[model samples]
Structures are given as structure tokens and as C-alpha cells.
Target: MPDQDLTVAVTGPTGDLGIALVDALERSRAVKKIVGMARRPFDPASEGWKKTEYRQGDVLDKASVKDALKGADVVIHLAFSVLGAGDKTREINVEGSRNVFDQAVRSRARRICYASSVAAYGYRSENPKWLTEEVPALGTDQHFYSQQKAEVEQVLAKTLERKKATQAYVFRPCIVSGPRATMLIEEIPYVQLSERMPDAVRSLLGLMPILKPVIPDPGTPFQLVHEDDVASAFVSGVRGVGEPGAYNLAGAGTLTMSDIADAIGWYSIPVPDLAVNATAEVISRVPAAPEKLTWVEAVRNPVLMKTARAKKELRWKPKYSGRQTLRALIDAWKREGPEH
Candidate 1:
């Protein structure tokens, strides 16, 4: 039976994925009211979510976070920062997360769903034959984002140890792609084929024939789950239907960079070792790449993930395949003109 009259609080309500989750919850009859906390006020006309009550709060402020968690049955803490220098990352990702968890405990919320990242696993050279819930986290100090996620996970575990009754669920999602994605893909530095190459050149290369590529060589396997699937995972976690502790929320299928490029009706030539080294030098001089290639390569080479735990426990299934996802992205990019 649905948990009717359930009041849920979703932090970072205006964020890319947060908006989608709120929309889903608003449509659900199980939830009575959704308390959406964000830095800015909510816009009602955006989607006619009248049942949503907006609260302005900062996760960094313990008092503000504590107030935001009051009168909530479930707390979905999604407020996080991914930019700025080293100090800011620690401030928001670690300190802010600690504040949110502490408040969730204080409020005696039944369930707390945290949105962690696959980066918490750091990078692995030898891909696991099959990733499972039991896979130990191989965290590293190489990247701030990865390290911070690991630290936050530790804090939550400790908080659970202290509180004992509050059920803590951690979702370590992979490269998520969907309608309003905020990731490296959308902001990638690349020229449109139409702008760079003539139509004839595109045709001769068969780039326009496939519609999108299915798989490419140099096969650096990667996984990308749709945003909706991620939201559903959170909903399931809140309902106590999924694995209680940590689980990987990765896509159903895996594809290589060549495959992804091909699926998008483009071709990929492996950045030569020398070119990669030179590009690193250039990027380091200009601005650090959102995630260093070495960091990405460690995670991308073999993104082996198992969704069995999520499926059996949470009743979760991804509707979109990697190919379908890439096609949708291309179509959206063509129509929207990449303002996102």
C-alpha cells in the first residue's frame, strides 16, 4: 500500500534532478505535501505544483537545515556544490552535508536518501566482472569531488551509528543524462559537424546514416542512467523498499566512447597519448577540466555495475537504453540549441 499522508522534504528543489523528483512526487497520490527547500523562492507557474511548499534555507547553516527538516517524514538531501576552488568544495560537500545529516537526525526523520556519486568508488583499472552492493569503496585523494563524496558517506554512516533508528539510504548514481542534465557532456568543447564539415563530407563518412552510433572501439565502457530512473530510485529508498544501506544506481547497459560518439551520429578518434598529454598541459594551464581525464578514464574504462539489488528490492528498472539516451540528447540539442 502507498504511504499516504507522507510529507517529504527535498533539498536543492531547483536543481536539475531535484525538479524532476519533485514533479514525480507531486504526481504521486502517496505523498500529501512536498516541502521543497532551496536558496531561491519557488515558481508555481513552472508546472502547477500547488501542493509544493517552498522554503528558503541554506544547508551550510545548521539552524536553517534543522528548520527545513522539521515536520518531514522523509528527507531527500540533494543540495550540493560542484564548482569553485578547493576550499569551497569542502565547505559545501563535506561541512554542508554534515549539517544536513545532523538535522535529519534531530528531526527524527524516518528515512534519509542521499545522492552520492560513483566517483566515491574512485577509478578502477581492472573493471569488476560484476559490480554489486558489497563492492568496497576504493576512494582516492586524487580528486576533490571523489574524496568529498567518500567523506560525506563516512559521516552519514557515523550519524546512523549515533541515531540508530533513522534509516539511511545512499544512491551512488553514474553519469546521469536526461531532459535537464547538468554534466560535462552538455558543456563539452566541440564543434557541430554541420558547422565544421560539409554535408557531403558527413554523408561520405556515413555519419548521417546511422542516426546514432551503437558502440565504438577503444571500448571504454561507461554507464548513464536517465534522471527519471534516479528519482524513482530515491522514491523507492524513501519507501524502505530497496536495499537499506548503499547501492549503485547505474544504467542498465554499458557502451564505449566510440559507441557513444557513433550513437550520436559522430565519430571518435582516440586522443593520442601525446595529444592527451598535451591537452592535459593546456587544460591545466587554462582551467582544470571539470574532471581530469585520468580521473575519468579510471571510472570510464570499465563501469561495471549491477542493478539487481535496486531492481529486486526497489522495483526499479531503467526505461531508456544508452543508445536511446544518446539519440534523445542529440535531438534535444538540435531543437534547444544548447542553452543548457
Candidate 2:
């Protein structure tokens, strides 16, 4: 049954997805209150959210997580690192997730919604062209982000199974895009540069086509779902509209690597599979290499998903197609990016 007039607790409620979710939950008649926990201080009223109460807390702090989540009927876990790889990041990704799941269960929350990624499917040579929820989430060893996502899912599963009273809805979204969430698009011009490089320099490079980094495109198609669509799926999870299981979320249609190059004003070039494979092979060997290199493996091996289950079960539909989402970002980039 879809619960109404509930207090929803959210971890990482100020992030890109969290902001959209906050808006959705604030406007929901079913949601009476929202308790948000983040490392930094935030005012929900700044975002025009009347029902949300903010708490300064870290996901790693068990006591804070527990205290912040008091009397929560639904819990949404959205806190995880994506760019860094080290003891701290891995600990936060794994143990921090464990903390969230444990507390949600301890509080006897009716539902838990976790934002997972298609990277959980992993960039493996063995992956099916279109992955379904039924497929195993055995994430590849290519990137820590992929590995940790899989690990967190395993933790959630075990905790939910043991508790039985709490249910979890796992949503696996593809490369998410929107005007507001420009993290991925911002990195496009800095592909060849070090991750530690300053953002100002990277933005300047993107402004000049000659200096812009060349992105290798093997012509593999990939999906980019709008961030709003992902928020909608989470809303479904919060409303208890879907069964307790994983659902793959993606926009209709697909875009190739060249399409991305065109979006950023011509930085795309056709690179042979052998070159990309050799680069990935080399990067994989350097265990101490920067986390950015970990994404190199994904260029050759794309993780595309089938959203039939989300549509059939949750009655979820993406408002924007893959092209529309990318196009919208391109429009926003013109106004906000280096070119501006």
C-alpha cells in the first residue's frame, strides 16, 4: 500500500538528485515531513521546501545517522563518492551505506530507496547488450565506483533480508543528465588532464577547440537518462508503488560517443578498439593510478540497461529522451560553461 502523510529521511539531500527529490517530496501530499542529513549545513527553505528539516551529519557517523533518522517512515540513501578511490572513499561507500541501511532497519522504516548505478552491472566484455534486473550485479574490478555500488547493494540486500520488516527498492540509473547536474559534462574537456588539475584551467581548455581534449569514440552506443526521471523512480519507491526489488531506469534511444563530441563543439574522433583496449589494459595494471583512469575501461565496454521492468511494474516513464536530455545540457552549457 502507498503510505501517506509520512516522514521521509534522506541522506545526501543537497546533491543533484537529492535537490530534485526534495522538491518532489515537498510537493507530495503523501509526504508530511522530510528529515535531511548532510555533512554541511543547509536550509531547505532556501530551496523553497517547507516540509524539510535539515541535520548536519555525515553518513559515516552512526550516531548522527541514527539520531537524524528518528521516527522516519521512509529512508532514501543517496550518499556515495564517485570520483575518488582510497581508504576514506571505500570506507564511506561501504560502511557508510551499511550505517544507513542498519539505521533505516533499526527505525523500522517502511521503505528504503537506494540510488544505484548501471555501473553496478560493470563494464565487462561478458555483459549483455541490454542488462535487466534479473542479471547478476557482479560488478567488474575496473573501477572502485562500480565495485562499491555492488558492495553497497549486497549490504542492503542482507540487511533487508534479516529484518524482513523493512523493504528496499534499488534503482539502477544510467549516466544521468540534466541542466542542473553538469558534473559529468564538466569533465568532458578534461579527459586527458589530471584529476587534480584546477577546474578553471579545464573550463578554459574547453573554450578553445584546438586545446580541447580529444575524446576517443569507438562508436559504442550508451544511454543517458534525465535526472528528473531518476527522481521520479525514487518517488515511486518512497510511495511504495513498486515491489521490493531492483529496477533499471534509462531514457529511450541511445547516443554514441561522437554525439557527445558534437555536443561539446567537436572533440570526438574515431579511435580503434585496439588502442582503447591497450589503454584500459595499461590503466588497469597501475593500481595506484588516479581514479579518472578507472573510467577508461568504460569507453570500450558500455553498460546499457533495459527499463521494461520499471515501466511495467512502477508504471515509470521518462519525460525526456536521451537526445533531449543531452540537448538540454548542451543548451545549458552554452550559458554556464566556459564558452559563456
Candidate 3:
């Protein structure tokens, strides 16, 4: 059980998962105060956010992170960079994680929870049918996001090995989905194209069967976890209920590119894996292409995992299935298309 009066500090507390986690904490009588550290101020309009004491801090800046974590009993490190080039993404994801963990140690925090991703397993055909926590997070070098995730896990592991008192909890989640996951939808290049066109033009374009045939097919098998369920796992870890170790987090279903297309009412043109990588290689050279595209080849490979560890250890049974989460995300995207 959690303490009756716990002061929890959450870094990157304004992101999709962060908001859900903070909301969960606020609902718990065990949590008395929440120190939300983010780069900007909280939304003044959110009643749920009003309860938190906002701290304007940057994880990239060690001193600021340390100051923000001073009196925290437990620190939930959610700061991450999902899309960017190598050096820029590493600056925030790798070095930034080190700062947070080091500061948590200096503050003598009892526990630290991290938001890791299944991408840490690395997208490869050789990946086992189901990954376990024992599997090292050594993603391929080409995928900076995957590489950074692995690097951060190494830092957390080393920190715990050196410090006897402090404990670490890492959740390697699959693609998380919910009403708040519109950001993921916006990341799709096709969706961005639709957003740029006029509304009438977009509607007309959607009706064109020929246009749908051109949609890129990302045939990789994947899993989806609800944002709320992930929050539950974190809450469980924070309350000293689960073992101090990494656990996979994902809902109870598997999906592929065709499933994603069906959910969003798009068409999937199945292409050979070789062709997909070839196209990605060409796009990598384009100046307009985001450096994050460097990982396209690696990510096209599937990395599936099971969540039995989280279920048995944390007693975390996700309420929403993977398909449910995907549907929710698609609906959210339709309602709030491409948030500025």
C-alpha cells in the first residue's frame, strides 16, 4: 500500500502519459503533494492540474532537475525525446536521464520510476516472439530513439548497482494509445498532408479510393497499451508494491499495419520489407526529412513482448484491450485533428 501522505515529484509531467499519471496520483488519497517539473507552466484551465505545485525546470539542465527533486520521496522520470536526430535526441534523452537519476540519488529519494519503451528491445526479425525483462535493452545503433532508450536503462541500472538504498522501476511499454495520443497520429506523414490541405479538399481526398492505395504500409507487428494502464503500473511501483525491476507494459492484443489501417479507415499497400528500407534510405538523404527517419529501417522489424511479469508482480490487469486503445486514439485524432 502507498503512504497516506506522499510527496511525489514527476519530471516531464505534462506529456500524454504524464497527465494521465498525475491524474491518477491526484485521485489517490495516499498522495498528498505533487511536484510537476516541466519546461513550461501547466494549463491553468485544468482543474486536475490545479492541485499540483508546478516547477519550471529542464531535465537537460542538471541543477534545475536537482532543485526540482529536492524534497521528493519518489521521482517518476517521464522526460524523453521520441523523434529527433542522434546528438540532439541524446542530449535530452541520455544525458537528461543521467541528470534526473543523479539528482534523485543526491536527494536521497527512495525510488525512481522510468518510462521506457519496447523499442529498447530493438526492432529486429531475430527478436524472440515474446521479450522478457531479462532481455537487455540494446537497440540497434541506427535507431537513435531505440539507442537512447537502451542507454538510459544502462544509466539507471548502474545507478542502482552503486546505491544500495535507492530502488529503480522501469516500464518498457509498447505503443501507448488513448484519447490523448493524437500526437502519434499527427506524426504520420499522410495525416500531415491531409492537415495541410483545406478541409473541403481533405474531405474530397478521403473519398478518393485511388489516393488511399498510396498509403505507406508499416507491416510491423506491434502492441498497444492504454495510457491509464501504464499510469496504474507506475502508481503500483511508487507505492512499494512491486519488485524493484523492469516490467513489460502492454494491453492484451496484437496488431499489424492492416489493423491500423482499418482503425483509421485508411488503405494499406503491402510492400516488401526490402523496398520499404530502400525508400527510407532515399528519404534519409532528403533535407526535409526529419533525422528520426534514420530509424525507419530498424523500426520496420517487429519486436513483440508479453506483460505476464507486470500482471503477476504488480497485479496489473489492463482494463482496455489493444484494439480498444487504438480505436480511442483514432477517434481522438478525428475529433482533434493535428493539434497545432
List candidate 3 stretches off by more than 4 Å.
44-47, 188-210, 338-340
lDDT of candidate 2 over 19-101, digit per residue (tens): 98888898788899999999987898899989999999999999999998899999999988766744569988899999999
Worst 10 residues of 1 by lDDT: 188-197
Q: What would the TM-scores of all predictions be?
A: 0.84, 0.89, 0.89
Mind sharing the TM-score for model 1? 0.84
Tell me model 1's lDDT, rounded to 2 decimals.
Answer: 0.69
User: For candidate 2, what is the TM-score?
Assistant: 0.89
Candidate 1 Cα outliers beyond 4 Å, as residue runs: 83-85, 126-129, 182-184, 188-218, 263-265, 272-274, 288-301
Question: CA lDDT, every prediction?
Answer: 0.69, 0.81, 0.77
lDDT of 1 by residue, 23-107 (tens): 7888777778888887887774586797888888888887788777888888998888753314556887788888888888888
Q: Which residue pairs in candidate 2 collide? A: none
For candidate 2, which ten residues in a row score worst on lDDT?
A: 188-197
Cα lDDT tens digits, model 3, 178-202, are 9875555656443343333333433
* C-alpha lDDT (0 to 100) for residue 1 of candidate 3: 56
Ranking by lDDT: 2, 3, 1
Indicate the residue-level lDDT of 26 in model 1: 82
